[model samples]
Target: MNRNKSLFYFAAFFAMVIYGISTTIIGAILPQLIDKFRLTGYSAGTVASIMPLGITIGSIIFGPIVDRFGYKLLMFVASITVITGLYGLSSTSSVDILRISVLLIGAGNGIINGTANSLVSDISGEKKKSRLSLLHAFYGIGALGLPFMLSVFSSVVSIREVFLIISISLFLLALLLVFITFPVAKKNMGLPLSEILKLINNPLLLLFAFFLFFQSGMEGVAGTWITTLIQKTRIDNYNSALAALFFLILALTIGRFLISFLLKHFTRFRLLQVGLIIVISGAVIIFSINNYYTTITGLVLMGFGFAGGFPIILSFVGDNYQSISGTAFSLIFVIALSGSMIMNIIAGVISDTFGIQYISILIIACVFIMFFLLYNLNSKMSMK
Candidate 1:
């Protein structure tokens, strides 16, 4: 049993690794993509924005399927999707094909993300909160590592080669998933309409989902625009954008690990409030300042702030709705991805008109919006 758990955990780790790569890969290669494709700002934004659309679709679909059929199939299929997507990205020249590739890749990543979190929650029992935090910290590790990998190898290898190598690596990961036995799915043959209605109407669930919407939106903007913001502000020192991106991802990694310790003493709500304060401060600093160093600092601050919310909220979902946790998670994630999509799509349009600078201002507004949701969620959870 212990050995099986270890294998499952490794499977979960690589699952997140795939997601991390997919999540950051576009941002890492964006400049190169633009030069190679000769795309306009609007075209670039369109390409970038479509990824979340695919992710939202995958998130919406994976829940009930994973609940009924188990994680093995979905995870296997997701890995293959990521691999195929990368291959398409590596080989394609047409922006249309590029869009399709990234869409598939994003979908794959989202499925793995939702499935892995739900699986870890299922296995960890009462320790779901801390365990989920630790599991996702691997995601941060993967996300943080990829940009650096690209940075190091770019001089030696073409961007296409980089993605091709990643695709092969994912193939191995998919092959490995075949042999590891996963936890069995919940035995429900069908979801009742009444239960579906209850989930739809659950105020606490809606609040939690609403909170995540902003959470994901903030993350979407941070990941996609941080480099652009840095590049625009520091024309001569373009690499600093990558450096700042590094700091943001690293800070997120450290912050998630910090969450384990935080759970020991801090109530989840207090921790969440603290995270919000830091995120808001970062947003304000980035919006107000122009320096590259300040931008990095602001991003790192927001990183730590964004770290604690998802694990705690997902834990609440898992603990309360253990039987149908997959579907519940799916619902929340769909809402969250919609938030990301709305922000990215709007930010894309805004970027073409005003400037990427507005991205920070929008994130700041999102942080404040989350304040209201958190209060409502806190009130509800406290009563429960």
Candidate 2:
């Protein structure tokens, strides 16, 4: 790769790391926030819910902007938004301010996440799936790092201090992005409304979007609830629960890294089918067994199982909608984030009404639905 492309790739990878950390930061600090703010369960859930809402809004708007304006300005501004969010989160005492901060973080990360994936897909040509998988491995690193940091440093430092440190690192990332060259806008004039409607109505796009719908839902649920489930069912210690969550993300990271290489040997469709099967198997393991090691094992399998879904499906979207990929991605992400938000809300309700252990059943159901969706999606692709 040339120097500019190499730098762009680095920027994309680093952006994903930021996305990863943003994703888990809420979960990592929830308990502390709850205690510090004296929040009720309902109030805490509201705070958790607001972030995805922000992400959804961000995903909805970014496609048109990136397609018309290129990535540098969007990424730079989004990074600054995230940095400000982090600063506010570290310093704020008011719940309203906290909510706003979370919203800023989520919205900023949403833009960065979508932009990074779209950027990588734009440049990766036929290797979009593999490259996207590799790119998301950095997300795993960021996801795992936050909880691990909390687990190790909670006793030594305040969570606020940790947030400040993370903000500093992100500020540096934002600065680096300013000097890097990026791909020009893919659709400088932007897609017409009629064209966007047609793309939205396209059957293949719908399939891919809903497939991601469940995919994002499953992931959001697992990422958000796994720590609580582990704590409630298997362990009483918070650190051990964080450890379980860490193992899950670690497995996901390793699986993505491996998938990047494995795609060279396996067809994307076939590998995705196998990954879905693994997800089902993992969900069953989590549902059937109660042992700590077994739960961890189940989480690992699910991590590996989930590793392929986004990269493969989003690659398909990119390949099919090359001219309006940013818009296409935005549509896909809007649907996907909707699924994430809805399912997370449902999971919260399930936790409140039926108990946390029952969450495994919801996960199992989602995996089965995803399996059905994948079959339909694959059949449709084959027909084409």
Candidate 3:
């Protein structure tokens, strides 16, 4: 890759990290938010799910906009939205205002989620999947970083201040995007919406989207509820569980970087299969482990297992549908975000009724579904 391409990749990677942080910082601080608001488990999960719900709406619209406009422009707009949204989140104490802010954050996230990997996929030519995977590794970095950063300063500072810092970081990145150039989509160079919709129906792409829907749900289950689940466990205390969850995110971040190297030697499909297996193992371990230390180990394995799936699936979409990369990714994200929202709601309900301990079993089931879907996807792709 040329120097510009390398720079673009890093910029795109940072965007992913920022987006990840925006999405997850809430998860890290959700327990506190719930306490402040006096919210039930279901309500807290609903608030957490709200952003992805907005992202689902944005995902549906962004494809057409990106096709009509361009990635650079859409990305700038998205970053602006994120900055405004995060600032809004920091400014609000009302539950309704908080929900609206999260929605805007989701909209901003939808734009970045849809566009960044598509841009990398477009620019990297043959290295589409690998580039996309590396970009997502940065997301892991950001998601992991949020909890660790918060854990460091959480004792001394407030979550509102954290939102302010994240917002400022996003605004600066938005300013930087003004100087960067991005690639145009091939089909979107001139294609009509009708033609784009036809292309969006590609069976392979749809199947991948279907797989990702469940994958996103599984990932959300862990990301949103891990801290809460830990708090309910035999951990040292609520504070200790919160700290351990951050460590789990850190493990996930580290695992993604390590897997980036491993991807050079393995196919995305093989890597996904391995991830599903690891998740299942983690879930089972969660069931068996009685001690807090063993529980953290299980959670770390779960995090490591999940770290690879999104990046790999996204890279697969970009690699397969080069011309309609943005559209394809948007569709996949639409379903995935919807899945994230719906399953979180479900997890909330299940936890409310049966308690959070059962979340491990529920997550195990989702991973098994992912395993089946990936196995089928691999089989079909091979036959083709």
Candidate 4:
């Protein structure tokens, strides 16, 4: 890579890392917020759900913005919004304010994510998916690393202070992007909503959407339930279970980084097929085993398999249809976000009714759905 491209990649990766921390830190700090606010169960669930809800809505708005206005403007706006929202969250005591703050932060992050990935795809002529995977891997790295960094302060400081620090970091990054030059986005005159809606008629895109929907759900399930799944083994302590969850996420982050290197030598379909097989085997192991080591191993395998999915699929959309990249991203993200939201809710319901053990079963079932989608995708491609 040339110096300019290298710089852009680094900035994109750093930005993604910063954004990842913004989203995942909430998972760790939410319990503190709940205790601090004395929130009811339903109230807390509603509060927690606001971000994904905002992301779904944000994608709708951002797609047109990115398609029409270009990356730099959208990135600047998104970064400022998220930084401000985080600052707002840090200063707020009211639950209503916190909800609104989270909504802004979530929406900002979602827009930034979409814009950055779309930009990466635009620049990467031949190696689109590979580079996009690396960018996303950095996101995974931040998601894995930032929590541990935040945990160091959890015992010593308030969650508000943590958000304040994150807000500062976001501001700095936003300023940096403000000064950096980016390539002009292609002029798109299409109706973003109509273009996105039109993707439904494309069989491959529809099949890919289902694959991603299940993939996103499986990821959310693993993030939420892995600790519980490990603890149910009765051999590991809670600390170990938590460690397993981090390991799983770290594996995913690192896996995407490794995939960037491998993409030069492999086809997208080939890599995806191998990944699905690994995920299926991992799910099976997780469901059948009660041992901690085996469970952690299985989680890691599944994480690695799932790591490149979203970026690869998004890049695929961008590569195939230049005129409708924004619309494609919006539609695909809606499907993925919906699956993530619904599956998370389902995991909670299943855990409450059938016990936490059923979450692992649910995850395994989602993996099967992934298999079915991938199978159909592969078949269709083969026939083509």
Among all candidates shown, the one with the greatest TM-score: 1
Would you estimate the TM-scores of all the predictions?
A: 0.96, 0.95, 0.94, 0.87
lDDT-better candidate, 1 vs 4? 1
TM-score of candidate 4 on Cα atoms, chains taken together: 0.87
Pairs of residues at least 3 apart in sequence or in different chains that clash in candidate 2: none
lDDT, model 4, position 259: 82
Instruction: Pick the winner on TM-score between candidates 1 and 2.
Output: 1
Better of 2 and 3 by lDDT: 2
After superposition of all CA atoms, the RMSD between model 3 and the true structure is: 2.0
* Superposed model 4: Cα runs more than 4 Å off: 1-4, 30-47, 88-95, 156-158, 188-196, 225-242, 284-294
Candidate 1 at residue 366, lDDT?
Answer: 91
lDDT of 2 by residue, 1-384 (tens): 589888989999998998898888777767677778987555666787777777887888789999999999898888889888888888899999999999999899889899998899989887788899889899999998888888887799777777777788788888998898788887778778999899889988998989888888888878877877787789877888888888889988998999899989998888888988888888889889988899999999999998998888888888899988899999999988887778777877787788877777887788778778888988898998
- On the 0 to 100 scale, the lDDT of residue 323 in model 2 is 85
Pairs that collide in candidate 3 are: none
Tens-digit lDDT track for model 4 on 1-384? Answer: 477677677678877887677767555455456577986434544565666666666676676677776677777778888887888778888988998988898788878777777777777888887888988988887777555655454568666676777777777777888777776555556465555556767898888778888887787667755654565544445456556767788888888988888778887777777787777777888778767788878888988888767877777787777765766776777777667667766776775577656677777788777777877887887787
For residue 246, what is the lDDT in candidate 2? Answer: 87
